[model samples]
Target: MSENLFVKWTILPQEPPQPLLYCKRCGGTRNFRSSGKIRVNANGKRVDAWLVYKCMSCDGTWNRPVLERQSVRSIDPLLLASLCANDAKLADRLAFDVEGLRRWAPHLKEASNAVVARELLSETPARPLELRILCVVPCHMALRLDRLLADELRIPRSRIHALEKSGALVVFPSASRALRKPVRDGTKLLIRPPAEDADWIARSAAYGDDCP
Candidate 1:
């Protein structure tokens, strides 16, 4: 029987990416924070909407368009109402839309706080562990797979490299270079640790609040 342990990890960005935009009032580029507000304008049957952001340095307001000249009927009623009410979650989703933010703030600065949530996916500990990584939200996180593993497994990154080279650590899609690439949702990692290192892996920070 193959003893394969399965675990799942969800990567969540703690905060929305704040776009760095030029603030006319501040006379320079400044980080803009989501004001958690939406502004809408109606013209005929067209609706235009924007998520409002404010410059941290001077409180200057900038409207990042969420929808432009969209047909009123095409908009979901609940979403439309949420926009009208300035719903926090809706505003957050829009704020995290890096592609949308780029339209206006072409040179926008983006960052993220990568918070990982882990779960045990199997009842038995297999000889080789198959770890499934799921991203909970979309954001520009700088986290790399190797870094996350090092932090979670409480092991040195060099150890991770050795495992990869020895074919003990296998990343799915074979062609994927997860070690150096930014961690993405739906990436899977298969790890075969040395028997002596099993205890250390079992006590990984993934199971505790002592995240590194």
Candidate 2:
């Protein structure tokens, strides 16, 4: 491989997955979004905590239990304090917990849309260089790797497949077909575009730019 140009792409899912639940007010199954709040109740030696969710249709509320009737002594002090304070980070993490939400309902609706923030590591080289991208994902997302690349690069998924087949684009952990899989944290992609196409791909990977 020649000298490489690097870019870090952080993929953040726009919203947490919504669990479809029977809404009493709506009289039907409705999607619930996180209210970004925590509800805590203290009853003598026991404590209860829930991450609050609200119905998208009618604003009906649901308390997704974080913990139920657990002794305060068993709880970590920092966690308990953060829950009491309704810490934004903690709430966000809870909201993205699709597995946790599954305990209450099996049906889930997830937003595949994401915000991709890219930071270019080096200037364009005199010669075409290997374009390396590190995918930094903070939470769960429904978007596929191929879909993301196609959208960001303004190229069709078929183009990506062609590149992979011709050995121009290399995705890490060759054991799996990650191109079609959900975008994951810490996945690395290396693009060795032919000299003719290298410059355009580098620019597109770093920002939203139309190639000449």
Query: In TM-score terms, which candidate is top?
Result: 2
lDDT per model, in order? 0.74, 0.87
Stretches of candidate 1 above 4 Å error?
126-140, 175-177, 203-212
- The deviation in Å at residue 193 for candidate 1 is 1.0
What lDDT score is found at residue 203 in candidate 2? 79
| Range of the 10 consecutive residues with the lowest summed lDDT in candidate 2 | 203-212
True-vs-predicted CA distance for residue 140, candidate 1, Å = 4.9
Please, what are the lDDT tens digits per residue for candidate 2 over residues 1-118?
Answer: 3467888999888888999999998889899999999999999999999999999999999899998999999999999999999999999999888778889878888779988888
- Per-residue CA lDDT of model 1 for 93-209, tens digit only, reads 888777777778876655534677777665444344443333343465667778878877878999999989998888775655778776765667777678888646754623635
| CA error at residue 183 for candidate 1, angstroms | 0.9
lDDT of 2: 0.87
The per-residue C-alpha lDDT of model 2 at residue 53 equals 90
Superposed on all Cα atoms, the candidates' RMSDs to the truth, in angstroms, are 3.2, 2.9
Q: After superposition, how far is residue 106 of candidate 1 from its true place, in Å?
A: 3.5
